[model samples]
Target: MTEPANIPSDALTTDVLIRHRREIVDLKQRIKNRRLQVLGLYGTPIVILAALITWAGLKVFVWLHSNTPDAIDNITGFVVFFSGVTFAVQAVAEFSKELSTRRDRKTPVRELKLELSLAEERHVLEARRRTPPPMDRQASYKERLPGEIARLRKESRHYRRIHLFMQWMLFINSAAISAVTAWYDPPQPAKGVLICLGFIVTLITAAAGYFKPRERAFNLQLTADSIEQNATALELGISPYDAVEEKRNLALFATTVEDLRAEQRMREQQLDQPQQGQQGQQEVI
Candidate 1:
């Protein structure tokens, strides 16, 4: 009777940690979906209420301009009354449904978060127990580099998109205001509202300038690209890694990657500081 080959404890621990990590990810996604559901449930009524109020306002405006103002007033009053009552009923129903859902759910959001936290802690503990060889550690770190690169690029893309959207909004608002003022005679109240919108666009422009999303996106992309270039060079055993021995090359690659990440963090911190603070720091330096 030949004995089956025994699996390495390190491999078994790695496998367990991988599975546990997947479970944690699933829990996090579930929590996110549940929160979104709650938001939509409550938010729909508020959106409906806003739309109804806007419709009522437009009706009132038309009634004020109509010849049969009293009859229109009676109709508007009934519409407004029914709309308010409907909104209240819908709001109460949504609240009750949310409450009932909370009561019925076996694992609520808070419990799921707690479970996720515990799972993360267990993963950390298990990872700490297994001591990987130096080469294995280097390989593991290298494997994680791609994920980090992807995350940075994703953030860069997000910021870039936001910057573009804000710019377009500013342009469209300015053009609309110009066209309306040049060609159409609006009521005093409507003119005032348009002016307010212009002010809002100005504020939006100021905010975008202050936050510098475009610059942030550029910095993130640059950092990600630098890291990727170094990683590729290290993997292909070219340039910097070419002259070094295998273990030394791995160690150097790890150090270089870490230094790049630290520099990226520093850049992010600098970007986060206010202009005045940055100027003061520069003066001190």
Candidate 2:
């Protein structure tokens, strides 16, 4: 009998890797099914809208070619009526989808996802348990903090760019649409469609403001920077970190980082509360 030579103790065993790989494949399939479920849930209104648009469009086309004033006026009326109905229906559908997604956050599907995440974490822990503990685990952990900080910063920048893009879209499109409508003074049917478009854009802008993705990204970046400062101070033997022992310093860093994350979550909840209150009030009305 002989021990296997040249095998890294830290490397994962074939069986463990295969098991985790299967779990990952299963998780991916579950995610795809969840997406299909969402489409099935939210797609009905869109399908209805498409059918109405097709019917209305054909009527308008036929009436335009007929060159009858009465038919044209009828077409205009249909455009206005359908536009309003479409907005109402779309708004309701979107609100329902949002509520459904929020509810689903705590549903069994999401629980299964959380379980999968836990399993992956357990796999990592098992692998670590099998490996001889590194002599400088604390130092290695400290060394990784800068990379984590960079990752968070990059994500924040990405979100900021998206925020800027959305702002530009709202401003530019609103201006362009308004200018074109006023200058051209398009026919009643076209004008109604343009108005509907403007309304849609306004709704999108309002939704973006409510969600405030950019603000969340900024907060995450700030937290990462705070953690990075602490990590750097410890590494450089500066200030408060200078007096703390190695193990205690690592514990303090971890605790502080968790506290920062908790604070960020609290702020997010506070921001969401007003939006939820407004929604509730709207429902009451």
Candidate 3:
């Protein structure tokens, strides 16, 4: 007789997700980073305000030395021109990156959303109250959750490393800009350039922050779906060969399909048996 599958003690209770605590922490950090990105995006106008204020101050201060009001206007005009150019260039770069990232995922990311929905649906439909007690009804499902979380955490680590690196760059650039500002006597060109560069880089960091972690969340859902779909095929009596072949065409996950195939083969072989028919005939004779 086949050993009964291990069911979690309480069939009605859902598994407490445990494997990927690191991923959960990372995901929270990503959210905080994304919010900061949004705040940075809004901060662009503040740069213009600072530049304008500086130009105004220079114009007023120069009046004491040369008594020429026109000097302030000229400096202000130059500042405005350079500022406008920086904005344009940054916009173009952002637009290009947006286009490329969009194209990379031709199909919209439904993996995370759908996986969540399916998991909830399955939990509801199984109706633990109806299942036989002392049975490991939820064992398979519970065992699978931790692995899913662990895999998601693993998937996010790649993107997180890239993000952490970019943040370090920003921190360095900010310091460099502050240093240049302090070193110059008048019309600080080095400071100006560093400040402008720092602002631009900060914007870029924000954009990446918004989208990258979402991609990782989708990665987790994609993996969970893959395993669930594979298991479903086996339960439906599909042959191991067919499960393997079918999984090859799926879009997002990369798991070894052999275990599922083995399961299908085992089930098929069991069902194909002649059963107790021959023994009954011999007994009757």
Quote each prediction's TM-score. 0.63, 0.50, 0.26
Q: What lDDT is reached at residue 151 by model 1?
A: 96
Which residue window of length 10 is worst by lDDT in model 1?
98-107
Candidate 1 per-residue lDDT, tens place, 1-285, comes to 232343466658778888989988988887887676555555656665666676567667765575545655576556656656766654454456554434313446788789889999988887787667798799789889999999999999999999999999898888877776776565454687688778979988988978889988998999899889989998799989896578887888889988988988877787789999888877997
Q: After superposition, how far is residue 81 of candidate 2 from its true place, in Å?
A: 44
In the order shown, what is each candidate's alpha-carbon RMSD? 8.2, 13.8, 23.4
Compared with the true structure, model 2 gives a TM-score of 0.50
Look at candidate 1 and tell me the lDDT of residue 245. 70
Q: Which residue pairs collide, candidate 3? A: 7-136
Q: How many residue pairs clash in each candidate?
A: 0, 0, 1
lDDT of 3 at 92: 50
What does candidate 2's lDDT look like per residue over 74-120, in tens digits? Answer: 76557656656665654454457554333233245676688679878
